[model samples]
Target: MRIAVTGGAGFIGSNFVAFFCKNHPTDEIVNIDKMTYAANPMTLEFLEIYENHKFFKIDICNFDEMENILNGCDVVVHFAAETHVDRSLQNAEDFLTTDVLGTFRILEIVKKSKSLKKYIHISTDEVYGSIEAGSFTENSPLNPTNPYAASKAAADLLVLSYLKCYRIPAIIVRFTNNFGPFQHPEKFIPLAITNAMENKKIPLYGDGTQVRDWLFVQDTCRAIEVIIDRGKTGEIYNVSAHQERQNKQVLFKILSLLGKDENLIVQVPDRVAHDRRYSLSCEKIQELGFEPVFNFEKGIEVTVKWYERNQQWWKTVKDKDEFKKYYKNRYPGL
Candidate 1:
């Protein structure tokens, strides 16, 4: 299989790429990334040693460039987006431009290509807003609360439209909160872990009771592989680890693993239009043989050890002016 992955330098994208390269050496994987502030090319540095892997530093909105690059690919996994909810609350135009317009362009190219097999759109459960009780099925109506979730919801609808109108071989995969190694420090888990590592206080929003089902990046990659091979066209699948944790609970786990003091957690203002909880039904994907293999306790332990060992990977990044500005701007009262 020839796979083209957008946002391949980002957290989950890199994880998928790495797993594909190691497990399926015979298949070719080409990655396209805009190399945004949240993305570090170094995360995908291992691609340098893999002959089957090729990477291009290009934005998804560049349709002409992406059209040529994605030609003849069997699958196109779209992951490129401005994904930070806090950052989106500050400036949402980039989110619309990158998430909406980018998807439109990618869809146009995929629709016109004869050799393309399936388009896997990576979406989020935030599209369903807060589900206080029952798990949201794939048919649940979208009710996005924040700009970031709204943008993703829009893109998800666009992908479905193409599948419906043009009969494109496309599937949307909505994943719950994902955390693992190589995640950008701007994300919640990485931010908490890294801050705790430096003996600095980790920021917790409001009462830190926002509930999100956590999915390990590796498990997500595995499900994507299953979808790539067995997923039905014009369908949507929910992938999760069934490990739901409150934001504060996740922080406590990280602190416990690192032997850090409980006082390191500082409560801050919550997100504007914050969703109280997001739970998804993963039955559809399970029918396709997708079950999360990693337990959150064990996965998080491995993730903490990774940050502890990978000082060079993120220390310089955290010290940069960009990182400082982002931290000051995003975390209130820091």
Candidate 2:
């Protein structure tokens, strides 16, 4: 099988690449990535030795370039997008271009291809906005509160439209927040860990009461592999670890794991239109023989240890002037 993966250099994308390379050793993988600020080539460095793995540094918005590279691939998993909520809130143009328009370009190519077997779009549970009381099912109406979520929701609808109008075997899998290695330091878990590592204050937005379902990266990778093989066309699957916890709870856990004092946490201004809670009804995906084997406590420990031991790996980027500027811009008062 030939598989073309966009955004293969990003957080979840890089992890998925390693997962695919190990599980599908005989399959050809063409990893097309834009190599954005969040992506590092070192993540996929070992895969260079494998004959079945190939990397192409290209932007997905360039339809002509993507069309040329994706030809003859049996499956195209579109994971490319500008995912940071704070960045999107600051400026939505990038999200619209990369998340919505970029996806349209990929779908256009797949629409004309006869060799394509499936196109799996990686979506987030944030499209449903927030649920303070219960979980959101796949059929729930999309009420995206933030620009990033709205852009992803738009792409999701576009994918469904192609399925209906062009008869493309496209699938969408909406996953909750994922945490593990190779994740950018700006994200919640990594940010907290890295901040604690340097004895810096961990920024907590909006009272730190926001709730989220945290899923390990490996479990999400395995689920995506299953979806590529067994997921039905034009279907949306929701996957979660059901490890829902408030932001403060998770932060305290990080501090506890690192043997740090809780006084290092500071309450900061909240994100624009921040959702209070996000939960997903993963019954549909679970019905397809999906399960999350990693418990939250264990996963957090492993993740904390990884960052604790790899200070050099993260320091190279976190200590950079570029990242410093962005970080300051994102958290001005902090």
What is candidate 1's lDDT per residue for 138-176, written digit by digit as tens? 999999999999999999999988988999999999999
- Candidate 1 local distance difference test against the native: 0.91
Q: Estimate every model's Cα lDDT from 0 to 1.
A: 0.91, 0.91
For candidate 2, the TM-score is: 0.98
What are the runs in model 2 whose C-alpha is more than 4 Å off? Answer: none
Q: Please give the RMSD of candidate 2 to the true structure.
A: 1.1
Listed per candidate, the RMSD to the true structure in angstroms reads 0.9, 1.1
Worst 10 residues of 2 by lDDT: 40-49
Stretches > 4 Å off in candidate 1: none
Q: Across residues 141-249, which tens digit of lDDT does each residue of candidate 2 receive?
A: 9999999999999999999899999989899999999999888898999999999989999999989989999999999999999999899998999999999999999
Error of 1 at 334 (Å): 2.2
